[model samples]
Target: MDTTFPRLLLQHASQRSSAPAMREKEYGIWQTLAWGELRSLVERIACGLHLAGLGRGEHMVVIGANRPRLYATMLAAQALGAIPIPLYQDAVAAECVLPIVNADVRFAFAEDQEQVDKLLEIRPQCPQLSAIYFDDARGLRNYDETGLHALDALIERGADFAKANPAWFEAEVGKARPDDVAAMFYTSGTTGQAKGVVHTHRSLLDRAKAGADFDALTGDEEVLAYLPPAWIGQNIFSYAQWLACGYVVNCPESAATVTIDLKEIGPTYYFAPPRVFEGLLTNVMIRMEDASAPKRKLFHAFMEVARRVGPALRDGKPTGMLDRIKYALGDWLVYGPLRNNLGLSRVRVAYTAGEAIGPDLFTFYRAIGVNLKQLYGSTETAVFVCMQPDHQVRPDTVGVPCNGVEIRVAGNGEVLVRSAGLLKEYYKNPEATAEVKTADGWYHTGDAGFLDAQGHLKIIDRAKDVGQLADGSLFAPKYIENKLKFFPHIKEAVAVGDRREKVCVMLNIDFEAVGNWAEKRNLPYAGYTDLAQKPEVYQLIRECVEKVNADLAADEKLAGSQIHRFLILHKELDADDGELTRTNKVRRGFIADKYGVLVDALYAGRTEQFIETVVKFEDGRSGRVSATLKIDDARTFAPMKAAA
Candidate 1:
């Protein structure tokens, strides 16, 4: 199409001028913007930024929730031939400093007062940050800060600039080329400092169109933008794909209102990480646990049938008449209402990525008729490497290589990919770029897995994390941890058994789910710490661990990876505490280093271990959390046929 994002906007406005382009919820109401209106908005912002000294090739940072104004601001930056860098809005100010300094960002568009405060707090460290424009004007009216302006004011300035020079907008936008740098997304920095993943317009748009075509997405598809725009997956699904397919993108009012907004929008094309899906299912199950006996009984009876026959029906497979009748009845009585309740009733093609989803969780959606599938990709790949085709979704494998993507596995089991969608380079870090991208165009994915006989890609774990046990059998922590997380009561788990005699785990129980279970049994506790140490809770967690072990025993290769001992931590694994990445992926090595004492206790077969650790409070205060956490043993099943 030879299109930049701004050019695509112009085309849409020219072709489908009156069609809905974007919608946002505010004060409990949704306001829609048409394609023509969006084009005008982008032009005005572009001219305004141009007037504000934003020149071609300069970097502008975009940080905040998925607001329409923010999207326009990003396109506006690109319209001026400036590259837009998106940062995680939930990140601490210290984390933001590195990227801003690395990019030498001069102007930024923050969503609201909270985001503005973060930018201001780091202004001293980022002296080059000359201008700041905010979308929401809630708490900034009284502050007298230099170079701080409202987004409305920017638009007004843009309008005046446009009137004065009508040709300037088109001329600036015409300078943008398909191969120009479009956006920069930072890695999660699991091992070290985050790196800026640079992607050109050609790479992102090509993959966007490929995905949209594979799913047959069109303007009629509705998408809810809830995840942080900083993540490449969210950017691809909500931004690139929206422009590629000319779909209607909906922005939630706030994180708190995503569920309500999701239901109201009833998005047809949706994407979420595994954590979101797991949380939703946990909440639904918690509610079901509290339902009256008769209601629960009826729900379970129908759900059992859905679990058996729903996926077969969804995949257009053959089924006996009696089974079909039972499934139809179940859909009417249980599955239909459940899908509607989860805001997935209208979902035609939904995707989960970023991490492996549990089988039970994946099947639940498909079993209830939501075509939820898994995809495999990362920021460097423009987020589209593999996708499960229609009627071929499986929880075990991610999928076959998608259009324009070639995948191969190294002798060490690391997956490698070559695609037009691969990242151009890491900004200012050529050495690091050379490490991942080769001369022949293959990008080392660092994920360990191989293609099965059916050509499906099965991801085991990170190549660095995949290890062998003391007995020379293989061990994959993610494989075992995901099995534990499949149980709604277990929210997060980390397995440690690399080159060890046996595997042990530390986990965080889902507070809400456990609390509900406790309340139902008339058990009382004060808070997370008090509840987590309960003997009954430990027993509950141990049973979940044993179930996973039993499942592992059925697989010959993974049978040796069964968890032998486990403990429920006195605290949740949190990003603020540095136990997890911003995307909530566990930083396994960091956690191991931080809690070396606990890992030692688990291996030593201690029944209880007392430890006090420093924790960062939400308000930036530091305090100590002390607990004598109890460790418990779990039963490991013998494999049906053990590995040689």
Candidate 2:
């Protein structure tokens, strides 16, 4: 009858005692822990926290990269019936204050001295915050000892406590209920303050079970835990799924070193946002371009064979014996190594969520034999609403609702869902919660979508952002932006002019692709800001726009979204600048306000303009950058062909 997360650890430990639980790279070495060892670590940490006066319902914050200790602390909190709140290690001192205050976190297990200092800096402001425990003791020689405690020292103290009072830990865990709160996640608000989403143990477990039912993951599969633990996606993938399906979670050494760690793990289960996948594809293409001539020729030849047979196989089309044999040879000779190089050789069930994945990026992985599928969910829904099932996967749809989940579209095309995994409420924000949750208990997803005959959900865009042009045709920016992102030269795109003369857009060039083009032409640049403003870069973007226009013209469902005008911004949008969220979602309102002058220049009927913008550096310094802006008429394409 244990309701805490520690039971997940003990459950797997007993069932798969010898199975590898976590592997982290440190100082050019890979460190591993079997399931039994991982469970023991959690028990010791739990006993340590208990001896330090932490008890049931207390809050403990974990701040660090993906590591065994960080994960151990999470389970330790659950072992004592305490809630574990995860904070993004990269968040600045000011950004950390709100969540710390909201959770009323007094005890914290920080990865390094830097994070411990961040908490200490705001200790005066946060009345509930007191004790700070650090895993790495580097640079802490001068820190005060009143509240600072080294993890090693605490573990020594806990060993004595476990010998004296072993039953107390079990008693506290027994008090926890399935509906009792397990964690509080803070999601950045588009309008103002961050709201804490409270999730219960039942919510997490049900969500994980739904996900397992959706994809039918096996126990032998492995997952790479590289994304920020502050994200719900990471919580579900790294913790909940491990509990539900007994899959192993691989921890990367650090964010910068994920690629190398991924190669070593060769995980069977993978999940990433569209940007991450796009970057991976871009990097692979760049490396191939620099490969020897013979390797390049052989790679392309096999890819050609893959291009022909892979799609047919994916679609279950009939093929002759010779074509099947040729495909097998191509896979063994070319696609096999390509997958190995990208750390996807063992990928069985991969998923892309958080944003629409370009069809090209989607197909590339499938062409190489990875079952890359799309999923649809939000933080409020516990990240398990719909997922494309194996072999029934479609590029446009985000598969059927998961087990025990129900979804329906309102008359206005807004999606509504009801599931056991739904959040109880926005913590202390009943008014806001009441708005999103209906009296009948359906959670308004705020996304506009339709269900196909196959019962798959086809999301068009946000419900509010689905506007109409003067001709009354739908203008879905995300739909068009996904089309633009499919092009190699285009990286990020924003479509504007919803109710105006025509659909205009802004494009961010793929820096690596455009920078390489500049280098080959002997065009030198100081940085991204300078390179992006080059006149030749405008010509390059123009070609990309033309290509996207041609692709759109062929698709009748999206012909009205063709670009009519566009201008490249001098500076890239950064999350720290408030233009993007911590989750990497564009803050459309903030961007529109910050770049209002640039937007004006694009539609002012002028070919050229100048803009001066205030920029903020990571070190809390501010400056200004003024550059001449170039505006080009967005490429126009032929109208949709008459209905057959």
Candidate 3:
């Protein structure tokens, strides 16, 4: 019953020696590595790291995509009693400097030449960083630099060291304890600077085991590890759970090839944020537009039937014979092919977190036979606070509290949790840690939610993000934004109305979806900027806003929060532009400050606003984009009176 990650890895390797433990897509084919092989590889890496001056209790940074080698490196660090800090691969060098410097990372591993170059460039700023290793040696053949070594060479060194000192590796692994910190993860910092959240072996393993048991997962289950390992949710699913349940973990070749790789693997368990699902649905809708008239008709007809009975069939609810037959036909004609195309045909249990998913989007997956549910958690809680049970799933709720977890709402409406999976501390920041974690051990979740009559948790929004209107009405921006994002045409929305007279929003259109819609009408446009500025596009978005307003009018609590003014953003919100965090959470304060002029124009009732924004490219180049965005007003509905 050892719960430490290294102990679990050793146990699984001995019990399932020849079973497939990990797979990586390489050169267009899957390369499998067995459990025994994984054990030997991790042992060599641990020995090599020790031989190369990595000491117990020291820190090592892993910056890479979801690669088998990167995952092993994490375990290898743990095997030697060293801690691994995984960073987002997409973060720029400047964005990476803080964590590298703060963690005092001396040894580092990068995915390829691009990541190695970034580490090398930032090395001067991080004098503590002594060694930089890379897995892919494609472009490092010519460069000669100190403290730069290939991972293959390190593993070779490790193998030689292991032969010379066999007992050293085992002794180090034996030294690991349940209370020892297993890993360090940096928060996404949507509100402020990222803080390192540290968790112990016992805390993380307990949550992972609870989650696996809740879903009845087995060693035969398969999962795709494509999300950033730096995030707590990804590490919980891909690392802790993989070792806890002895499941096979598959790593996609690259970010660009995830969709194709997912199809090839056909994973049984899946987890994605709401945005990924939205993008998948958007692509499907765009393609359906170009299909033949008969094909389009067939899709729509089956979809209507699916909407009627898909959820009922999925939940094993009773239905009439005629409805059941219609659903069967729809499943054969639409649901089956659609699930296959989206690579979710084999998804036995899927969950989405990090934000509130649109109800329409959530229902679509369940209606199409994808068993997609929602969970609610944060980095400080080890990513499992609330999870939906299969038969008890509901679109508006994130289900009951997870096993071994306790949840209660504070007087201010912020959710509070006390669980074995709670974080140990915010590394080196006692002041920040004290603000959230109380003396009584309840971790303040900072999310506003309430338990329903059925003991299900329903998240309203971030407690800090909820505001009040000038007329003293409740205003929740995320509630309104989720409504806007439910529309296929609107990819991103930011609502603003704290202490303002009425709610207004900034919009970003889905380039592919709206572009396809425009082309069908023979409306020519040059690019995103041109299409976004087109008068027809404004009219289209106006209709969407009006529809949301009508829906809001029907609800007494949020009727006053309806959108009154809106403008299409001059450009899409980009992580590089500081509009979004690395994990894709909007930086509300940063966006508001950067676009203050636009917000001013919206409230002032100006017809148009001129803005010039500086943007950064992938290659670190900077440029400016200027536009004259027109402001549009939508018709608002009067609130309905409740029966007395």
lDDT (Cα, tens digit) per residue for candidate 1, span 1-644 = 46889889988999999999999998999999999999889989988898899988999999999988899999999999899998888887778998899999999999888889889999999999999999989988898999999989989999998999988888888888999999999898988889999999999999999899889998899999999999999999999999999999999989999999989999999899998999899889889888999999999898898889988888888989999999888888888888899999999999999999999999989999999999999999998899999788888999999999999899999999999999999999999999999999999999999999989999999999999999988999888888888899988999999999999999999999999999999989999999999999998888899999899889988898898888889898888788889898999999999989999999999999998888987666788899999999999999987556
Candidate lDDT scores, in order, read 0.92, 0.82, 0.92
Candidate 2 backbone collisions, by pair: none
lDDT of 3 by residue, 18-73 (tens): 99999998988899999989988999888888889998888899999888888889
Candidates in order, TM-scores: namely 0.99, 0.95, 0.99
Task: Evaluate model 1: give its lDDT.
Answer: 0.92
Worst 10 residues of 2 by lDDT: 1-10
Question: Local error of candidate 1 at 203, Å?
Answer: 0.5
Candidate 1 deviant stretches above 4 angstroms: 642-644
Better of 2 and 3 by TM-score: 3
lDDT of 2 by residue, 1-644 (tens): 13446666777898889898877788878788898988777777889998788878877888988888888888888878888888888776678888888777889989998788778778788878778889988899788757789988887777677778877655655677888888878885654678888888888888887788766787888899999888899888988887777778888877888999899889998999988899898888777777799999988887877777776787677888888888899889888888998899988788989999887788888888888899998889999899887777777899889887899999999999999888889877899899888888899999999999989999999898888777776788878878888777777777876777677777778889878778868999988878987888888888888787887777776677678788887777777677778887767767777787777877787787788888878765788888887889866789769677
- The residue ranges of model 2 lying beyond 4 angstroms of the native Cα positions read 1-3, 190-192, 292-294, 555-557
* lDDT-based ranking: 1, 3, 2
Clashing pairs in 1: none
- Tell me how far candidate 1 lies from the true structure as C-alpha RMSD in angstroms: 1.3
- Which is better, 1 or 2, measured by lDDT? 1
